[model samples]
Target: MKIVKAQDFDLRREVEYGSPEQNEAVRKIVADIKKEGDAALLRYTEKFDGMKLEAASLRVTQEELHAAYEQVEPSFVEAISAAADNIRAFHMKQKRNSWMDLQPDGSLLGQVIRPLHRVGVYVPGGKAAYPSSVLMNVIPAQVAGVPEIVMVTPPATGGKAGIDPYILVAAAEAGVNEIYRVGGAQAIAALAYGTESIAPVDKICGPGNIYVALAKREVFGAVDIDSIAGPSEIAVLADDSADPVYVAADLLSQAEHDEMASAILVTPSEQFAKACQAEVQRQLAELPRRDIAGASIEQYGAVILVGTIEEGIEVINRLAPEHFELIVDNPMGYLASIRNAGAIFLGPYSSEPVGDYFAGPNHIIPTNGTARFSSPVEVDDFIKKSSLIYYSKEALLSNGDTIMELARREGLEGHARAIEVRLLKEGKAGANDDNK
Candidate 1:
């Protein structure tokens, strides 16, 4: 890793919008699925995933789900179950109930919160198959009371015609019985538009390759999507008090995820920056995925030198990293200064992987500077909110004239008349009731 002055380093990275050829290919795939439904889904699955399947074999059977348990160790099951409990407990606090506020004028105004009917979670197959992702995506929807949680993955794992057993076990543990063997853009289309075998979902969540990301973008308005996620990122803001080994390790955790992933360190001390830079190179050589992590660190990683800790924070806000670590003498002292991180780890012990797996926060965080405007996946992603309005006769009559005046000012006579007609009829009824 090269150490550079913070002001001299360019923070901008070109966003991946997919090549024109890839975009055109995804458009064709999505259009085919929308038009032909199940046939297109099957054809694309066979063409891309190399699995020829009838509609009957699309859904994973309950027996298969149970058999997945035998394949995985009891230790894995116990760990996942404990993590599930922590996830459920943490998200339950975010759950909200429908509420109505009654006014003195006998009017009601509030919000009605309801869970989505169905949701689709895409778990990538092969090397990207992560059981932790299944728990992260499904558990939140479950906590939000989503009734039908559907999962889809590639049919082949390691060139075989079957899903990963670990993925199956995780889905079963998360209470998702509806699992499908499909992947790539075709799977995203199937989830959004629905085929003969799989019902359409109200929302889609999870991470995937470029094709899957493009498919989600294409079908966004047709169904809700979590986000078109970018590669992982981690930025550590530390001083001389921090451990170079710990900081270097945390940065590599994200760098290993993808060659495009970024890992950087912003520090006030030049000596500390040099230490971390040397430590990272030493650790990178020993990493199992050194090729991937080494590529990321070589291309996107940096050790930025700042004049002060406050200056370091300003640099962090500009980058808006997906994961941030504050490892200083007083991490909490600078807590309020951080405004753009997707997830913040305050101390040396609160490693990023802790939150990624067992800490109960969703690991599906925004990346590529998206943390400036977005957030990690949470319970709110699976629920929709509708405003509630119940106006009594008195309440409507009291505000009717004002409402009509505003509506007519906008040249909406129909909207003005909607209030005018109600006011006129209610006025007459009130007069008659008073006379009686």
Candidate 2:
């Protein structure tokens, strides 16, 4: 990790995320899946995941889901149930109802809110498994009233044949019935385009590696995808009043996620910056995942020194990090001025992992400076909105001439004529087919 002044840093030019090979590979996989369906998907699974499968065997059996519960401890089951309750309680607050407004003209105008018919959640497998991700992804969709929620995880973890038991149990507990033994870009393709076994979903949500991110970008129009999240990154905004040990531990929390993950600290106190730098090095030695965390810290970690907490806020907004922690004298006082963070944790106790696991907020957040324009995945992501406009004879007669004028001004004579038809029928316009 390096300690540097903010004036010397250019965060935007530091890194280039996805590679051409990754994009090309994903493109080829998505194309093959679209063309060959089950056959292409099966081939990819065998080639990439080392799992040979048939169309009939792709979907996880109910027996597997039930048996998964037995493999895990009772305490684990209790924990998952509690997490689900918290997640459901939080997202249920975001649920919306279809609403209409009646006009004085006896016309109706409203917005119709409806959940997606089906949704797909992709859970990463292999070296790391996040059953927490399964809960975060499915709970919001379930809250939004999505009837069909399907989950796709890789075929194996720790070189075993079946998906991780924890992930399976989490899915079963979260009310996800349809589970598929597939992953990576092929899993994304199967979700976007239906196969013989797994049906297409209206939207896909969850985080993955670069290949999965690129696949989501490619299949965007075929099915709605949550934002393309990059490597997990965290920016801690602290002042002299902050704890250096607490700051260092929270920074490494995101760093341990991936070698590409970034952990940075922004503080106005020079003493605090040096203290955190030393604390980070000391703590890095004790981590079991020291290699991964150290690599991430070496590659992407930094302590940025600024003149004041106000300047630190400017730097935070510029970075627009996925997760932000404010450890200052009064965290809430700075909230109005702080703009660009996927999730803001106030005070030292509001550590990043708290939000990652037990906290109800979605851990699947916008990453790599995308928080400037994007948002965390929520219940709204699982639903679609339709505008409703019902015009009555009285309403049309009152506003037809103005509507016709605007349409004709845009040279859309057909649009004007459509409005003129009703006006003419009601004796509100001159006898002419043209809107003029």
Candidate 3:
């Protein structure tokens, strides 16, 4: 790992911008899926996944779910159940109730929250069977009171590794109503367009490969999508007191995810920076995914030895990482200064994996500097809010002239006329600003 002094602009940009191939391939897959539907899906699945499924058996049934339950170890199922409980408990607090506030002029103004009727969730299968993702995606919708929840994952090959049975149980624990043995861009297309085997959904949430991300981007107009997620990222803003071993481990946790994933360390101590670099190499040698992690570190990872803690904060805000770890002595002081981040892990004990697996905060976060704008998946994603306005005859008469004046100023004749027409019915006001 290369240790650079605070002012390395080129390295920062490289870490922030992800691979262009991911974006280009996503576009092609989305276009193919849109034009060809199930046929396109089949071709790509065969091309990428090497799995063949006849048209009729795409959706997984309750019987299969029961069999999935039977397939997994009791301890694994229990762990998923516990994790689901934590996710549910955390998200339930995010539920919003419709409310109306009465104004002094007898008008009513407020907002109503309504859940989307149905939604589709995509879970990556094969070597990456994230049962934690099942909990994170499904539990929030359940909390938001969505009536129907559907899921999609690629089919397991002939008697080979299948979608984790632990994930199936987690789906059950999180109140997911349906599951499909389909994945990739095709699954996203099926959910968006509704083929013979799948039902169209109001929104789609969760994460997947580049093709799936492109599919979501392509189908955005057809159905609501959470976000076009990029590679995973973690930026730890630590001080001299922070543990290099723990920091290195947490950084590697995200780096091992993929070659595109970025793990950065922004610290004030040169000693801490060197210790972290050495620790990452020491830890990487023993990890199962050493090659992947090492490649990620070589390409996207960095350890910047900043002149001061304030400079570290400036760098973090510029990077706008998806996951941020504050390992300083006073985390709360810096928390207020943090302007952008999808989710923040405070203190030494609050590591990234806690949020990824057991902690209640949804692990589905913004990536590749999108944290400056996008947010983590929450109950609000599955629900919509509508502002409600009501004006009684008295309230309208009082505010009518002002409303008409604004409309006339904007040259909206019809808007002015609509107010005049309402006022005329009551015979108490005119189209002038001074009703006083």
Q: Point to the candidate with the largest TM-score.
A: 2
TM-score of 1: 0.96
What's the true lDDT of residue 274 in model 2? 92
TM-score, prediction 3: 0.91
Which portions of model 3 show Cα errors greater than 4 Å? 9-47, 157-161, 432-436
Give the better candidate number (1 or 2) by lDDT.
1
The window of 10 residues in a row where model 1 has the poorest summed lDDT is: 427-436
Ranking by TM-score: 2, 1, 3
Per-model CA lDDT versus the true structure: 0.91, 0.90, 0.84
In the range 252-297, model 3's lDDT, one tens digit per residue, is: 9999998878899999898899999999999999999998889999
**Which 10-residue window in model 3 sums to the lowest lDDT?**
9-18
- Local error of candidate 1 at 229, Å? 0.2
Residue 136, candidate 2: alpha-carbon lDDT: 95
**How many residue pairs in model 1 have overlapping backbones?**
0
Ranking by lDDT: 1, 2, 3
Using lDDT as the measure, the top candidate is 1
Estimated TM-score for each candidate? 0.96, 0.97, 0.91
